[model samples]
Target: MNRRFPFDIARQEFGRASRGNVAVIFALAALPLLVGVGVAIDYAKSANVRTHLQSTLDAAVLAGARESSPSAQIAKAQSFFDAQRPEQFSAKTSASFSVADHVLNGTAQAEVPTSIMAMFGRETLDVSAKAAAASSSGGKVCILLVDQSRSQTLLANSGAKLIAPDCEIHVRTNVSPGAIINAGVNLDVKRTCVKASTVINNGGSVGNLEKSCDAISDPYAGKMPSVSIPGASCKSENYNPDVSTVVLPAGNYCNVNFSNQTSVTLNPGMYGGMNFNQARTVKLNPGLYIVKGGNWNVNSGMTFTGTGVTIYYADNSIIQFNGNVNVQLSAPTSGSYDDILFYEAPGLSQSNWVINGTSSSTLRGLIYLPSKAVTINSVSNVSADKATMVFASLILNNTNWTITPGNKAMASSSGGAVRLLY
Candidate 1:
């Protein structure tokens, strides 16, 4: 062994050193695996942070959107984030906000620092979140439509206010100037520019109603009883014919229309189901018309005009004003006959309806005021139950309307859950 050459000994040493280096190579090979595990953990943490940030941002955005003021919205958003997480940890937080025509949109971003993964030279991971909210500052209006063609009085009796802070009054009527206009909001004669006559006070602030007296322009504006319903226990129980029966026991008369140009004036008496099928015209003189039984159906271009009329629907009584008829309800009751009025507007069909009521009368069904306003002038009590009253502006003149519990009342009190989105 001692007789070995120097070169041979060197070669053997080199081979041994190469074999030792295998361990180093194997360790180096596992470095990427460790890096991968660290990366996965970092990603998981980032995802968790992202979810949290996203949820918080969503809540904040929603809160901001509900607010009407844009500046307030921004403040609220910032407050939300501050309350959720500290600013110190939000070093790399990114946020953007914008508002356009009452619509608020925003986005949020943050960075999640990699803990174990940083040891492998990975510094941090990025996480982002976004949310949006919309604020509503649009105009809120309730159009009041009245049939001035017929002698109707627009009254403000209950504790009611206009739909908007400043509302414009417009009137164009086919009726004469004797129509009574009670002013509760304003009394400036100049403001009552509408071509109407005789504006009175409603014991409230007469804001500008007087100045806008001549504001409206347009015109004029049923019925029956028959046992047309079958499969019913009561006589008029389930009977809903196109024409319904209304009996004004003695001194009461109900309005009946036979055509648009022609109307049949009925006296206070009982009526069989009147045909509202072919553009019928009807007129009612004064007095109460009681519902004995049957449904009133309006089919085509029918018009029902009333001068002084009162209609009462018994517990089981129902009135179905069909879709095609243009019915005008006029009457002088304890409240105001102009409770339901209609005016002329562009693109609006003459086929509209006007309704009036006294103390605490419940109306059930959809009532569309296509052209004018739905004036609830009943100072004593009135309720529009299950109805859709549309107008340019909805006016709640001191018309005694309250929110009471029960199906017999309006969907009020239960949050006054009236949804008006125009």
Candidate 2:
């Protein structure tokens, strides 16, 4: 589910055209919504409460559905509704949310003080909106390719298998040789959609595929983390502690170069260019980590226990890991970035994320990298437990790995596409 890099000459020649393709795809996808909205202007011929109420309700339910916990879902929905509901109806509009069987249902009610219908003896028009959203039930995209110009954006080498039958694999590139499946590669996915064609080498097999489909647009294009955290500044130098055992506080730390035999406890906050050079045991507290720029490299004999965390990778950052390391990291269960582990902030620069950890490493979350290519070359079996959604520019698999990216059907992005299923 990944590939080789495109040549610099190719990038220069086709970069503009590729971008144009994305615009066209976006316009086409938005056309239906635009039309639907235009038809809504009449809004029962009143141009009143119901129309805006419906849109806001839809958004609230969708936001709620993205979270895993019931309380978090309801809280997020109410927050969005309160913040975005029309000001004119702020005092009159109210909404409630509930979750059942993984589906988030919401209802909004508003009383429009009739501006024109008052003469008809009706002082107020009672209106309501209902919406439902499911975060998981299959059919959601697990692996997404955002680059449209490069050939081999998705390449599955020999013995590689994409073990995601519960999700869809989308190839957005329409260029020839868009995707290649080498010998012994088996795409074990629900469906594989390609804009152009998939070249199959000897003994390559693709199950449930659709060719010549419209490119699936990036759902997390503009919803990246901020380049810098609010009220926080960059650290000036490297973190070299005097003692072998340390408990780093929740603040900005620069140049995270770890040495051998150091037992360190890192409280959640901002870190710069984390590198694990020697054997060290690192424990991460539950919180958010805003890591700005540089190589997040991990090497030899390191044990890490980090559950309930989110790593927001900003700027031109890359992830490199080696075998012989044991690490377990789980994503946060609540908040705006819930269910997401690695969130790559949008940038002009393109990068690569290489995960080459050993069998003992367990990571649970959506590795959301919208502007990078990722390669999973784990020598031994590692589980993507609880959640394992991989959103990238492209993905490569060189081993037989079973990736069940959870059962939740929501997009990795909070602003991702959501329909009003009444």
CA lDDT of each prediction against the hidden true structure: 0.44, 0.67
Please estimate how well model 1 matches the true structure, expressed as its whole-model Cα lDDT.
0.44
The collision pairs in model 2 are: 1-395, 2-155, 2-395, 2-396, 135-409, 136-408, 136-409
Using all chains and alpha carbons, the TM-scores for the candidates as numbered come to 0.32, 0.64
- List residue ranges in candidate 2 displaced over 4 A: 1-137, 224-227, 230-243, 386-392, 407-422
Residue lDDT tens for model 2, 222-244: 65445457454655444454557
All predictions: root-mean-square deviation over Cα?
A: 16.3, 26.5
Model 2 Cα displacement at 203 (Å)? 2.1
User: Candidate 1, residue 256: CA error in Å?
Assistant: 11
